[model samples]
Target: MKTYLAHGTRFEDTALCRFLNDYGHADLDALHASAREEPTRFWAEVEDAVGLTWHRRYHTVCDLSHGPEWPRWFVGGELDLFENLVGRRARATPEQPALIWEGDDGDLRRFSWRELDDAARRLTTALARLGVCPGERIAMYLPMVPETAVVFLAAARLGAIVLPLFSGYGADAVASRLIDSEAMVMVCADGYLRRGKRVDMLGEARSAAAAAPALAHLLVVPRLGTPWAPQASGQWREWDYRSLVAACDPDTGPTIHGTATPLMILYTSGTTGRPKGVVHTHAGFPLKAAQDLLMAFDLNPGDRLAWITDMGWMMGPWLVFGGLLRGATLVFFEGTPDHPTPDRIWQLVGRHRLTHLGLSPTLARLLMAAGDAGLPQPGQLDSLRVFGSTGEPWNDAPWHWLFESVGQGRCPIINYSGGTEIGGGILGCFPGLAQKPCGFAGPIPGMQADVVDAEGTSLLDQDGDEVGELVLRAPWPGMAHGFWRDAARYLDTYWSRFPGLWVHGDWARVDADGHWFIQGRSDDTLKIAGKRVGPAEYESALVAHPLVAEAVAIGVPHPVKGEVATCFVTLADPAAADSADWHAHETALIAHVAGLLGKPLAPARVHRVSALPRTRNGKILRRLVRAVWLGADPGDLGSLENPSALDALRDYRDSLEAVV
Candidate 1:
């Protein structure tokens, strides 16, 4: 009953039961032991063992001037990210295939390490000739083609920060980021195919560049047919990436990038308004990225893997760097998952024999909706050894189903959680730990996590297990350098909340057995008749019912009664079809919560929708829902993966007749 284990060795079967095993209890103890004695040295050894490149050796490992609040990592280092990812790979094995991209149209392409290096060189030289200088910014508004990745590294080679905007992002989103970074140039495609529809990226970029004063040129790569009317964008210029590379030099000059300098600005959904720019640096970016791939995924050279995401998101770089740094083959699909069929990803997994599978819970839920229609048989993904998930809490059903069905119950589903700023996961379970379903075994080896109370006190429940706001007692290499051009804002946002502690804003609590659980965000906490309630606690209660497929609960204002638990739930097929049964099921669910915890818990206000308005990474936009309930304007729908979902929910809101 495991995902797919060879020779009849099930996932539940331990080393004692299975003839073959990748890692077991002993390996976990060894990893923990190493971290206990000088964690910095332990991480450094891992970095060296995994063959990480460095331009100049570091003088100090870490400097915690204000404790873990404002710590400096990899102090006194200098190296361009491209050197670590591409340069050494090309030098050692030029012909080794670094990427294997498969578009939704079934077109496939492979780029060797040498070819990638040469292409990057040509692009770098062409950019240099155009007066592109160090410390400048170049925005990449391109599709998921190999050229997009090349453009990113090319910018990095010259110490220029590259900003990636999702091709689907509107003009406003583009203008905000472009103005923020003051990008001098933008790389984009004339048009691209998604589910076989033509999208005019050039047209969108053209309109946006008009608002951005700093943007000097529009560099278009004609991806589709011959040019229509020329885009009246900035500079009115275009470049054939391949042709420019052919004419340009194969070798560019050496770089002089500081390790702590800004490498990229990734945006996260802000509850208050527009997305916040989460900045990361050159040194911290690659160190833990490789470490995460090595130990957490146990990735080896030449492995093939893919995750579905827009390039504008953080995982775009994470997938690219983590896969390539370990010499693993990268795969990308530029269309909707359900375009040709629900089985698209499974088909790719089978076709490429992808060694690692990265997914989001929302994607899993969509696949679950397809039921038997979407999934292939268990052994179809026999090559998959590791599965990673991020963006939100992993529900038990989807986690168990994904583990048991596609993976065939053998591979480890690495439940990873970290922000874009961390470059990689602060909390991830390695294969060495017991691969329990829907559980994060523990924190990443070097990351020291703390679950503390509101007053900066470490809290443990009655069972003597930690359950509180998650904080870091010590700084790790992957922590964000700071917010871009806003250090005071960064301190106030993350550190000042609890004073001198890296309060991550998430409600993390551990069980008596030391298993960790993230109970949604602390900012998402609600007050129900004086008792503080977390959405995770309430949502978990609702999801335990057989009828529910997905659940989202937010506190709604009640004039005399303060706030009541008004939950919106999507039901499973048969139960949802029967109105009487649905109401009965809702009644039972509320009673179940009341019995479990001493409260009325409120009956569910079930609303059936095609989908929830989630982010690209699958995190539910609860703030958006709350804004709608209060009749306030839902600020910035830019991060929404499906903006149409909000329109569908208006009828449901009208049915409620909620008054702000």
Candidate 2:
């Protein structure tokens, strides 16, 4: 039996409805088919609908004669995204809010379209004055604040490539990206508040700047305080952000660039090997993001969209471009959603009247444990019409909680899944579709996605129950131009799996009802007794229990079976973890999983711990957990959010070995 959390209604007045009516598509299926059959026409209509301004029109929509992997879009067109998002929009509607920001301390700030453009123009003038050239790369090591957004637009306005680094990243992590991109000028903040604490951001940025020889200029934003003084002996010179902006003129226009000009280089976080810098272009990423938000999420003018993410993540840039291009307001909230009060997220939604809210399932679980203790009443979230989720696969427990408690069973949860390399969602749940909990309605319009077997045979179309790798049969604009200066690696990473098909590193399946669900990362799949299973299956079953807050299941070497499942569990109640019947409690949790998945798929061992290793984005580091459990070196700790968690796992493993 299929259970639907929500059903689509005929909202004839929505942005999506208007767009479909423009194309004579009353049903979503017809719209999707139109997009797939005539992608050029679809995108052309999108370009016109979004009112994208081009200095020079393109003679062709796309030139695939070179090859699908090297697609040239909007050839001969020249324009900057800032021109559409701020320049023209500001001139038309100067008083409308472009961005709204709130600090953890209840400090509120709003920027009108005119104000935002002026700030960006001033910053651009400052950067140009600092010797930042048209094609140079500038690194931004700042938090999720308005100034960060200003610098990004300013860099793009001057035809400079922006490199956004995670705020939580240390000096070495920052230096690695700077060295890789050879960024010339770097903009950073003095500090930012997180969980009521001030992180020493300027000190770390200074250390990273001192290490990167290519960094010639350091622009510091006095966010916390100007703690460090600029030194003549240093390799690069530093300037205060306010002083530089004040010295510059805001009455200037952005320098125009070609459609194919490099816009940004976002480094992908990895558990192994050096991180790959994924390059994007002027017309590619921003257009795809805007189109997705418009067509899929129904974002329109006056809608305030807020996605709790950092500027470093792909969602940050996606939200900025998607929301602003549609003349919608972007809402940025600093600090954790559950800080000061567990219902802080609800409070923000009520306070801002945000229409679209996006968050990860991991964060939902963290707050779900808090129950209604600090949560606002049910009616407080009435302003939110749509909920968006991404990052990792969701268990039913958290998904149900978010759908019923947070949404009050009225709003539909748009389960979106994509990557940094792909600017927007490859698969998305549309507004007018029958939705199953934790299942994607289908691939995003124009995306030819399929589940294929090891030999590249279609699994879902053939109605096979076997899980297979997800692959895209056609090219999309948002696909990264190529790894920065590493075309060979790019080819090997995506195209090498299947000839011409981009094999996404995820395990997916389709049930009889045609709903798609991503199980987990393909590399994280566990094989026990010749049967394959994703760790999410076991982890989901374990977390269904009341006592378990979160859990991670890993495949470990077994004496008899080729491999067996072992779980590291985090308890909801720390005192319960220390109870005298701890052994019996562990046995009960194992038995619960066995009951859900049967004895053949049962976990061989269960260990209770305070935390599991995760990336800064809240994805569980299964590879790192397996490495630490086997006493192997955990490669590439740069993206690991907590080094102490690794040490704790190592100590637990050593103690177990000692007893053995």
Candidate 3:
């Protein structure tokens, strides 16, 4: 139970602990009992634990007349999350820094609570004047600047659905989302920096808007106005969003507000076609994200939180609400985590005295590969209280190193795994529970998580641990309503796995000691000679090699075995790049994989690649790799922060066929 996730104070005897012990049941069972047996008391306990402000107290806690299938959240409630994030803080602490923004060009922008409120109001007013109505969709394609967060909150405050697109996405990808959401206006930028180069987002976005006829106004922020023009709207020679903000009154027709109003549409990759848009209501999103922030990481008022992410991803909203609602300062860097130097992240950790430093295992591996020869003194990360992992399953070496090297063995790494649909982790850690390396602690506070066999049967007894599909038998506040326009797909995707249960597409397990582990995406399951195996198993083994920096495993079409395991790796150093040395390294790595996962299922080939294509958030798009290897279309490369890696992959793939 020792943890650096807390503010260094032992909370073994807190209310959280009392509940865990008093029920005598397991965590999920206890949560279900509290939720069903004493419904009012359950949500009340949730509210108190989460520090939810009672603007107008509720009459009922759990009321599901339509059963769990069509559950209504907070019925007869009148709560606005806008008040929780901006109004509440602006009223109490006007001068506190609500957002700390840093540009790629080293420019710093800080917004206080009052400043954020005024800006959000101005932006909200501008949207209202543009004929934006409640429940309408506004597509936002921008970077990690202050304006990006402003537009998100502005759209949310006005009860408009915010659709976020990664600034790096090309016009085709951008057009798909805009048209799907039927967004009337698009909030974009003239250009944004990436790896010290300017990217013309506004120009491309304007082109994309043309395809989206529904797009009415292009609210382009001229970051580097240089020689850009809006494709359709030629009325303005230059578009200054600040001028639009200046012309509007901060008070805009009373702010159309509701708790259950549609807030945002986040897309997750579908089996085919464009990603499915997952709709989340305003009330549940901010409230639950805040609760997880408090319960999972023990976020505090003075803590400074920053995770390298873009608003297009779920972490964008999660970080926003979690940091702002709890009165913690947010550190926003609209640049790469390794920008300027590999030590930039560590430098920030030391400089900001960061109490909660969130990171990814991929980025950690990258830094570790950069060689701590470029690292700072051991005390540089002394300010780091807790380290967080999301987006992917972490490997043990990286996990142990993050605990031992980056955290200096003092901070516990919280391995959180959830999807965009869930808003927050359905399965995560509280840090008070015993943790094993590279394993999740358990489900979140209100979540009822279980690992079950393929036949929807429980795999373990009390405190049982076995590999199975991760499921939630009961409802939690963070679960999404459904895919924006694909409700049947949602039901068919999640609920169809079991009766009245949500089966998150992940292979998970719990050991006898109750430590949880995520194998990989269930959708990415590989069948080698009819044996179902997760790509993480092989990728994890390959990374165990001392020379391999990162690796990705995919199921390739094989004539004999039907599907064979293919692994592409990025070595620890470019000096190991020569095919001969790399081949030797791969030989040793292959030997290890064979030793770990014997004959028929062992890797068919271990190829060395210069780099792997990943999202801006640093998740290996293994599906893309598989697609390219099979000569299939790699759906959308626009979300990839590193597109050149795909070219490199294609070249390597061609080289494989050179001898074919």
Per-prediction backbone clash count: 8, 0, 1
**Predicted structure 3, TM vs. truth:** 0.92
Question: Which candidate comes out best when scored by TM-score?
Answer: 2
Reference-based TM-score, model 1: 0.90
- The weakest ten consecutive residues by lDDT in model 1 span 15-24
lDDT by residue for model 1 (469-564), tens = 888766777677777677777788888877667888887877766677777778777767676677766766666666777778777877877877
**Which residue pairs clash in candidate 3?**
465-510
Higher-ranked by lDDT: 1 or 2 = 2
The global Cα lDDT (0 to 1) of model 1 is 0.73
After superposing candidate 1, which stretches have Cα over 4 Å from the reference?
A: 1-37, 66-69, 232-236, 460-466, 529-531, 540-546, 574-585, 592-599, 602-604, 658-660
Q: Please give the RMSD of candidate 1 to the true structure.
A: 4.0
Q: Is candidate 2 or candidate 3 better by lDDT?
A: 2
Please give the lDDT score at residue 23 for candidate 1.
26
Off by over 4 Å in 3: 1-9, 13-40, 54-56, 225-239, 252-256, 462-465, 528-531, 581-584, 598-601
Ranking of all predicted structures according to TM-score, beginning with the best and ending with the worst = 2, 3, 1
Q: Each prediction's TM-score against the native? A: 0.90, 0.96, 0.92
Candidate 3 per-residue lDDT over residues 1-660, each given as its tens digit: 232343343446333554555544356456756665665666567666556665565666656686565566766566656676787788788998888877777777889999998899888888888888888998888888788778877887778999988778888889888888898878888888877988788768877877887777888787765765445454222245777888998853334354557888887655468778988886677777776777677677767898888888889878987678778888887777788888877777786677787778898887777777435577787777778889988876787777776666566677788878788887677655556777776777667777788899877574545567888877665678788888888788889868988898888877766667788877777888667777888988888888788999998877777888889988777685586576676677888988887766678889888889888878888888888888898876767877889899898778878989
Runs in model 2 deviating more than 4 A are 5-13, 226-228
